[model samples]
Target chain A: MCRTGPSPDPPEGGETTSTDAAFTALLEDSADELYESAPCGYLSTLMDGTIAKINTTLLTWLGRSREEVVGRMRFTDLLTVGGKIYHDTHFAPLLSMQGSVSGIALDIKKAEGGRLPVLLSSVTKNDSTGRPQLIRTTVFDASDRRAYERELLRERQVAEAARTQAEEDRERLQEALAVLQQSLLPAALPPVPGMEAASHYHTASPDRLGGDFYDLFPLDGKRWAFFLGDVCGKGPQAAAVTSLTRYTLRAAALHDPDPVAALTTLNTVLHERYAAGDPRYCTAIFGVLEQAGDTVKVELASGGHPPALVMRQDGSAEYLPTPGGLLVGILPSAPFTATTTELAAGDTLLLYTDGLTEARIGEERELFGDVALRDFAADLTHTAPHEVIEAMTGLLNSFGDGLDDDTALLALGVPTDRPDTGSDSPT
Target chain B: MDIVSRNNVTVTGPQDAPVLLLAHGFGCDQNMWRLVAPALAENYRVIQFDYVGSGRSDLSAWDATRYATLDGYAQDVVEICEALDLREVSFVGHSVSSMVGVLAAAATPDRITSLIMIGPSPCYVDSPGYRGGFSAEDIDELLESLDSNYLGWSATMAPVIMGNPDRPELGEELTNSFCATDPAIARVFARATFLSDSRDDLKTVNVPTLVLECSQDVIAPREVGAYVHDVIPGSRLVTLDATGHCPQLSAPEATLAALTEFIGNQS
Candidate 1:
């Protein structure tokens, strides 16, 4: 019984071995058949580059009888000119050192003078002594792949050009907004003697800036002319009319001393340029200052412009009113009005565009309208022009992503603290 | 110019006697002239050696770049004549090598008495209205076929080129001749041999020229050979009844008769 157990196990193992032998024989037969009929070419060469053997697939590709190429032709002879260079520079050296190389592209010269692109992979075969003797190479046709790659590159270039054009458009929009902002304000505010005056203008977005501007140049010593306004429409047409109005104001100022005459000249130019058809126009404020002593004389005009805010040294502020003024360019000889005020020490004035007052406050669609700005200005009555600008900048920042349109703010101030106690101190 | 290259060569021809130098084409080497050599040896000292990369010559010394042009082969012909100090030499080159003889003769008009051009062509391309027998494209196809079937067909076609080998394995050995030199070197020769257009040199040959046009030649047909004679200066066109390219093998008796008569007339 002891011997029977071991003997029975041997026969069982022997039966499994026979089954394995049959399975292996089937695999060998299939492999031989596959090699003879494979769709792609197969070849092997000596390390010295002589073609040692080849298959029917390659023979058919060459369109030659079997007796021709093998043993007589070297592998390099079959290459086209460009293919040969790639082979020498990249393929040959790589194959030699690595003893194998793969997916190498080549063009084999056909019997008819045309060339067929192909991908080749080769491995070095070694004898029992571990010395490489032959290279067995497999070739796959690659004509379709090359065509596809060329198409992809052409499409990519077209897409890159489109992206560049879109970027150029964005830059142009920002520049237009900047020019529109400049047209709303005077190029200069008439300078006041014995009074230190300064103002700041800040942009919200370069792509679409808030239209704001400020300037201080001499109308006369101790006297100045200044105004600020905002247009209703956006983009290039609005910018053209705004440019016309700003230059017209300067020209009319040189023609007459009256601020009202300057405002009328700007309105007439805007109407002629824009009011004919598809007219665009804006709201504006104009003012003239004349100083004799501690008190300075002032005249103001508004043409559908937001109210100008004034802050005094006594911690109180109010909006100077000149209502019922129409849009400056919509009608021929568009209606414009003026206002006057006396200047005091430690006084501040602010001008702004509707882009800021009309800004959305929250998801509720609530607007930070003119009243809210008036309240904000009142809070800054005791502050200087720079302090008011900084505070306004912080308020805009707190609005986060909600400021959808352009905003322009201009602020001007007269110093409360006297460094010299000069002519403005009743001396 | 026909190129002549040699480190050392043996030239055995008479000092003052009219020299007739013979060469073979394709499969066979210079030794193919052994049958007619003894006849010429009776009067003129004959010179013969293997081609640079063929037969018994040094294969290692072959410069692929130089020997790649038929000029190198033609140069050897010119040098052999000069080396032997032969004046008024008659160079009889067969098959592709005949063009080499024409070029060599054209280079040194004084040394070559005449060129016996067997088969020559200005170009292998077929003209719009004329057939040069094979179009240039056809020749290219033949070259590609040669590349693909170089091993098997060269062996199979050897006896046809060399006629009868003393041993059966001789055909096999000649088929493997492509491997005798580096396969790359053989490639250069194959291109230089078949692609040559030597018709331009024919008219420049100042010597009295004779082109032997072989009838029924598959390699160099009779009509094409006549075209060669037409281009050459004062050349006599003779068409012999022969079957193949190597008339020396296919019609040696007829070939011998022709050579002797042509040379004897001058003598």
Candidate 2:
């Protein structure tokens, strides 16, 4: 164990004499010497901020002599103009109330032109009676820390600007997609003289373009041409196929007016246009409507598509099946099955894309197949064409997130014998 | 919105006495008048309020576009006067709020009858023949200083700075809430305070105005105070024997004496 008291006299030796001299030198380094040359600056001021005492370290940092600073200057006189305002407005008031303030950053002016960044702390020194007498302060150099903080602040500003720019670009792109989507469908369907007609289209996502399409336009004096179809795939490629199919059917119907002839012309056009490395196809129902007296005759042909449904005025609904039809745009010579139906007063015919039957429902992911849709139609057998389309639109909305594909619906019916109203006029 | 709660307004002293509307400057809130308000309340009814972005006011009402200029702050003063239904009031403002007083008085001439400015400067940056004691570069350096000090304002200090009026005990817990404000709001208020030039507006002041200046101040020098007195047609100037920019805190007795004497003469 080390001795705490005075050690016994050692024998005279060279090593012992050198150790004694080193100890004497360390003991001679007085408290006053340590204070004047300390690493950080130290200062003492009167309660009103008159500089009463300052160490050599702080005097040297200010680039001033002890005589010039000690009695003549105040603490605020050593700060920059901005630091003076901040001191008067914030620091001095806070110290007066809090008794001590720590980790406050400020800038002090030197005798020369430059400034020195510093971190300062001060505490009030009270007399024996517990009344405040003076203030003791300590300061440290913070040049490196301030520089690093400035770098971080700059980087954050740059990142914020980039994020705002990205948001603006995304909004502009979505607007352009919406305008292009509107051009792929008709604005309104023309009104048939002795019939009622309605249509609805649903899009699954705004980011991608939908492939389903439908339109109805007058073909001649007493006949109208209509078609509904869904192209394979989605986006711009499927949109191009849909556009080609619509125009081909409309032009072929005006020339011949046969439902099978219009589908044959569309199949030829789609097969030739997309026959290279990438193949495209579609499922379509093309039909023609002819008004004869108070009744209308409907003839439609299907190309690998679902059959059309006919709801009769006798409160019954059935499918007009067009079986054995081959997929359009696949084979050079494809067969399309033609089916005929008559719509009396209060009877409606509906055509829809497969997006309705293939929709996934509930947590079980079950398909709302063709059977449920037929039963749904049977309840509305005596309704008008617009009423049937409105009910189907409501059913589509009820699916919510379960329906993930684009859908199109088209309905046509002969008007009842009641007095004609101008509400159905094509204005 | 209830204007009384939105501005954290406090009314004190005799209700039948003449009104004294006190407005604080840029750095602090209405608490800047803490040292001198009690003495003034003995003679006059004192009305104190904080701007939307300062003190315990509703910070949610602060809009970046509306608070971008000095006119927005002037609108706040006008709204407070209208809310209280005050008439023939003496408007006392400090620092940048001195110029804000000029605007509010010009907007509602009948309501605000007189103006008293402490450490007021119509402009901060120097112009052709005028010396406002600062340059454009100096203002930029001040903004940097504000940014550096904001780094020291930690999360633990947020609750103390954002006072809770619901619990009166929490208000007592705040000892250092004088100059502590949200840094983002402080930046906007700082830019609006320092970058404005209201020298042209000073000529339009037709009220009984008093300009108070400190004997030795680094922020607003004696020359700027003299310029304000010269521009106004009939204005009285008083030089307080003080050292800093804020005379209310440094030399409260002299500030209150000069204020009481001028207000007494006005009546």
Candidate 3:
């Protein structure tokens, strides 16, 4: 019986004979025969890498006889030049110190011209005295593995290149958007004769182009025209509307220096250009400043825009309201409200878009509102146009993430004392 | 930067003896000298360090722009000498590091006294009237080899290469982490080692130098070794009875004998 002295015997006699025959076949395979014909190549080398003995499987892969490889060639001679260098630099040093190395990939030069990729493992065999005498190595054919690894490396390189390209493209687009956004606004405010003028613009995000724009340019030798406004939305579409509005107002003011006529011209152009299914609109304050004796006379027209604030030299602040102004570009004939004021010495007039008053503040998400802005301006000690604009800029920055929209600001004032030169000079 | 920790410097042997600075080549770290370091340490103070981006050195200290050229490696050597306040030291450099030792010696003339170059080839690519034993295509093949090896380095191999202290069984099975460099860092080092041309700097060597060449090295052949010896005036060239490029590992006894003889003669 195959069980050899078992208490219980099998019920099937046919199965026992088959099992016994299989065991007999397995036991017939000798260790020496298995070593020579193993699937992997095996070899034994001296401490200095001299090939002392090698199996027939390794010899067959090398395509050389045992006489040529054993004792005639060192282990390095079997490797490709590149693999040899890698062995000397990386593999040899590790094996010597660690006493064993596993899964090191290298290329072996075949007898005929091609190369065989292999994964090699070697272990040092020590004598009874613990002195290293021989090295036992096993080599596995890794042609398929190496080919797969090469494919992976190539894919990795391509992915890295694509990522770098995408990053560069994103940076270039941002730069181009920034340049286009700057073109919609004035480079600088022209110097107003016998007055001081200052302006600031803040964008909510760098990626999306801001729709807020402002400019102050001389209409003639005596009077200066200025406008500050915000379009309905952000990005390229709103920027286009802002550009059309800015040029229309500038051209219309040259034709007629009256504030009402300049804004009316902008209204007509915007209503006609964006008159299709998707309508575009903006809120704007167009004004004119002229030297009237010692004070500057300011006349302004608003198209559903926020009322301008006047910070007086006597520590008083109030909004010069023009009520019932219709939103521009809603109809062919939109009614705009008109107002007039005089800026005395040390008095400043500030115009801003709704972004400042509509900004969210605190945990309650409460709006900053027009009343808070008036109080903030009244608390300021300096009434100069540049000082007012600077304080307003600081207030806007303090809002931080609370300010989620584009804001534009413009300030015009009369100086306390006249300068020696009557020529136009920027503040 | 704490230069000791940054470069993974390890000092052994007598504190009062003359210092021997051992520098490893590309594709390896300070562990390359493990076999030969003990023999040299018997009389000299042995100093071994891994280059930044090579071994257990502080990888955060590695800057691509700084280490892009051989001069950056030389700066590491100079800073190590300055940090230890060492003088009259013997520099033993293997492979690409041999050129680095030349640069470090020139930068600080009084600090490094002698240079021992083992299997050094200044230029790996062959040009007009020069034999560096490798063609440009062969170097590209070497780079491809590195890339292939890196693919196998990620999952199952990383822990084995970098010792696994968590499993004591695997820990004992762990080999030296000489080649356990970050793949990106290894790519840069491979490019620097193979694509560089350092032939002109050999003439600037003023220290007593020893050019040790293996009798049969696939990387640095006899012609390249002879070229290095001929360029440097008053340099000694000894052909060791070795097989591979790393004589220190393949023939440690012969490597030690040549090094000790050279160092003893300097004294």
**Candidate 1 docking band:** incorrect
Candidate 3 per-residue lDDT, tens place, A1-427, comes to 2445653544468777787768767776778888999999999998677899999999999999999989988898898767776777777777777788888888888898799999999999999999888999999999999899878888988999999999999999999998898888887887777888899998888999888888899888888999888899888899899889888989999999888888888889889998985799988899998888988899999989999999886668899998888777878888889999999887888999988999999999899999999889887534578888889999999998999998999988887774234253322
How do the residues B90-115 of candidate 1 rate in per-residue lDDT, one tens digit apiece? 88776677778777887767787776
lDDT against true structure, model 2? 0.85
lDDT of 2 by residue, A56-170 (tens): 9988899999999987899988888777777766776667656777767888889986888898899999999987688899988888987887798788678878988988888
Residue A12 C-alpha lDDT in model 1: 55
lDDT digits (tens) for residues A319-416 of candidate 1: 88878788777777766667777657667777776767877887897899878887777788656677887888787777776676656566666666
Q: iRMS of each prediction in angstroms?
A: 16.4, 2.1, 2.1
DockQ, each predicted model: 0.01, 0.44, 0.50
Q: Model 2, B88-152: lDDT tens per residue?
A: 99999998989999999999998999999999999988889989988887777777777777633
Chain B of candidate 2 vs. true chain B, TM: 0.95
* Candidate 1 segments exceeding 4 Å error: A1-37, A46-50, A63-77, A84-104, A123-135, A157-217, A294-296, A332-337, A418-427, B1-267
Q: Is candidate 1 or candidate 2 better by TM-score?
A: 2
Q: Which residue pairs in model 3 clash with each other?
A: none
Alpha carbon deviation, residue B217, candidate 3 (Å): 2.2
